[model samples]
Target: MMSKKLWEGSKQFKEHSHLHDYKLWLATSKGLKFKNYQELWQWSVTEVEDFWESMWNYFNVISHKPYSKVLSSHQMPDCKWFEGATINYAEHLFRKAKDNETAIIFGNEAGINQDISWLELKTKVASLATYFKSIGVTKGDRVVAFLPNIPEATIAFLAVNSIGAIWSSTSPDFGSESVVDRFAQIEPKVLIAVDGYQYNGKPYDKSNIVNAIVDALPTLKKVLVLPYLNTNALDNFPKHYENINHIFNTVSGELTFEPVAFNHPIWVLYSSGTTGLPKAIVHSHGGILLEHLKYMAFHNDVHEGERFFWFSTTGWMMWNFVQAAFLMGASIVLYDGSPTYPNFNALWKFSEDVKIAHFGTSAPYLVACMKKGLMPKAEFDLYSIRSISSTGAPLPPEAFDYVYANIKDDVWLCSMAGGTDVCTAFVGGVPEYAVHSGEIQCRALGVSLYAYDDHGNPVEDQLGEMVIDKPMPSMPIYFWNDTDNKRYKASYFEHYPGKWRHGDFIRINSKTNGLVIYGRSDATLNRHGIRIGTSEIYRAVNKIKAVEDSLIVNLELEEGKHYMPLFVKMKNSAKLTDEVKSQINNQLKKEYSPRHVPDEIIQVDDIPYTISGKKMEAPIKKILLGMSLEKSINFDSMRNPESVQFFIEFATQI
Candidate 1:
């Protein structure tokens, strides 16, 4: 049975909502009348062209050239949106900046507190842009960063986008090899990094990692290192490093916007790379500008001068989403440390101290707090917080109740599901919509998301593949290096041909029209909302001379409950020992990330594979979750057909 609505908007909230503003504008201009969010959504999906054009025009997108057509083609991977339109992504963001208004508010576990005004932010971005131009960096050049979630990272991203240079970033927490694996593919011209960052109240110096990455990337012509922790960090690094402070101090100028086509690449994001190398998914300037404007202004209800904060590392896509706050002239709140450092109340305290209006985090964080019995409502004064957003995983029904009963009764708790692919949520928060317990309010406007059965039949109120029938502005322009579009088509289009299979198991409530995400249908581990590829784990384990082969699977035991155990096929000469386990753990932490390290390590005689010698990660994942063996895998297709019995028996023991 489905849960009841947990929270509803007040009369004041409804009348003043950005959604209401959009409705009024549409009704006055387009003569579109919608009584509710459902009616509006119906019109949005059915009249796709009008809905997107309305969104584009409603945001008053500052395009230098008008689009010839809304969508040139409707085919997936071949969809060309906003054709002939020329725009710069950073232009819209800077246009909203105010001289006296605060642009950024930052705090960290180390008790660092600082704020950057809009004027200072613009000046910093301008300075960085000038420096990049001096070094021959121009449009379409890749500028990558390995930095913490600091103001400088945001500035660097803004400056890169201002000059029409594509930007990509990863958290400093990523292992050196993992960082290299991602940045090397893009062949960046300039690399921005930090000396160190604080997490869990401990300072971690990243000079060694930065040095190694710089050495690995021969394509880098310049390296700018920020002295985040150590002021003399640049002197310690063994490279021709330029101090970020020197560039800011020496360079001063106004930013010059570089206009490009609507489909011009703005940023290059990466896939989980479970099967192979991470696919460099590229997104365009115009598409992202329009999508974010709609998402922030309408869906998130972010108003000018309001404070918006989302707990994210540079590695996650949320960091990119947070930048849109600037486009709306809202102050962005950034924290560069563990949420639970010193105590679990740290995040709530930060919110209270900064007076955040919109606070966002992952489902696991809320579940951890609930389990630990840390009641923020009873302890902290979160008076200014209006909305709390949850993503990365499904929010348990219990979690929804806990948020209202223990956190804030009046606040809206929005649980959404979208991923790195779109850089936006497919189903997310709608300020005017009633939030049902454990369900996303509604599908995002301009997104045609629905569940489909294996035979391509659409289903509601039942689990199936979460498929998007129509393309949105934010879908990846293309996978970098995918010239023939073979890899891109196989990734999404192969499942349904025309529709995009997002590879998530989900269901939409027939009555409430809210979404419930079960988990990933693929082998990627989405633990703590971070997507870690299975092959990344294999890369670390394979390096161990004693290990023969390995299989890693993340099983969703229940909502917000997961068990990721590493199964190993060890060499006959090498036995499973404490030392070997420690080595594997250390290597995984060192090479991939701490998130990918398994909760348990178990020895197996053999690892299952297909006749084509491909690792059967999806089948093994299903077997461990107690799914029927016959339905999970075909015996004739497996090279080691008898090997399936081992996991089937093991599932029963667990």
Candidate 2:
């Protein structure tokens, strides 16, 4: 049993203790009052219908067509949410129109700040909407963007959604082939591009690549170029392409918004596709908008006029999530350059300057900050920050400690877990919960999550496959161009019969009432029929000094048996010596079983990652197995793909 002191001290648990109107409705509407997290979770699975129905009502999700039924049946694969409901995703997001409120604050490593008020944002979106309508762009038409995470990108997204047109985008850094691989498949009617982008004190000219991609895609009707960098290259721009100003000039009258069905496609977000071509995960208008609001209002506790900043690119799902803040009348902060370009304190400086309330970033960014040994508490006055959210990967326990000790004493460290597939979090913070050490506070409200053992039974206080037993409103409507739902089923439902397998190896701690996400299940290492998470080895290895980061892979022997091999990347001015390798081995053997010790340990200069900043483990595994390196789906932000050849050479030698 959890101690009373721990529960009360928890920021999340204490906030929900009082019986608010919403809380009362959730408790009685679904009979969800439980003695503990376990009881509430178990009851949620059994009473899936009541749980979701109550959640929709509790959140006050506006719908044109009321849901005739909450769920279809007990079938996991076929489970549906808000059945027969019709709603406009953009309308819900724009519900907050209170005058002159700050809607967006854009920044960069060069210390540039661009603030946009709600009224200004609305005007720009309306103008963009008028342009789209005048150009024969209508509902269901695909509008693709290859832009940075600037205010214009967010405006374009809202404009596309406002007119019921489907929007898809990638960061400007994506190569021509990678961009072509995705946008070509969708046959987008309109393409949005920027001339160039600035990153890490360098200017990258994407106009050439953008011109090349537009030349290849025959289905593209028109290309709209935004004058980025204030360069006079507009004349040098492609003759076939039209300037953004020209498109808006054609739009003359008041904007007219056409509301579509609840499941209308809003955006087509592609997977990294390191192994093959990327999968286009299509999210619905209602699902993305409503789920984001749920997370923003309830999970992040974002109040009106608060400043929100998340360092992300247009390629990342966080960019999409951050744009939703405009709907809440919050100031959405956007940064375009490297987080540590001029100094390690760039982001901190921006936070202080903007007086941000909610700050979101990747775990690696925090880990990198900790590695630099720079303390923000001493450098800057960060009294404005109330919450700090970390995602992209499992936050190391040491980073958690570093944050609490240096960033803020009373701020909530919300370690969120979800993927681009859903466009929102499945497990994250609720204001009424406590922040646990190295754990996400709680499963998202209304998301029926469970940890199931191999026997398909729910497990408690143990590591198991993370699955959602019931459907939620945020579940993807379908895969793009997948008429038969074949790709959708194969992606999520093929692992488990009916349940939504989230593909994470996680453990729910009954003692602390928190969750520990070990790593991705596909990346799980198998030794002597025992499945162990790779993060288990990382946790042990990262604890050692001189080791900045590490990656572990399971190598198959001649007999088809797998053995574990480890790779380490040392800190700057540090090397992985024999002593360091021995120390890592000793720690692994002592903490885990003897079998957990890797067969070999090698050092590498750097690790390859997806555009979204996840370590590309599957490609490394393929390289170790002597397989061809398949083209990456989103290669724009991918750094150092050639480094994998070093791993391949080391694998052959071993």
Candidate that scores best on TM-score = 2
lDDT of each: 0.85, 0.78
Off by over 4 Å in 2: 1-21, 24-46, 74-76, 245-256, 631-637
lDDT by residue (98-196, candidate 1, tens digit) is 888899999998777899999898899999999999999999999999888999999999999999999999888776776787899989999999988
TM-score of 2: 0.93
Cα RMSD, each candidate: 10.6, 2.8
Top lDDT model:
1
lDDT comparing candidate 1 with the true structure = 0.85
Model 1 segments beyond 4 Å from truth?
523-654
TM accuracy, model 1: 0.82
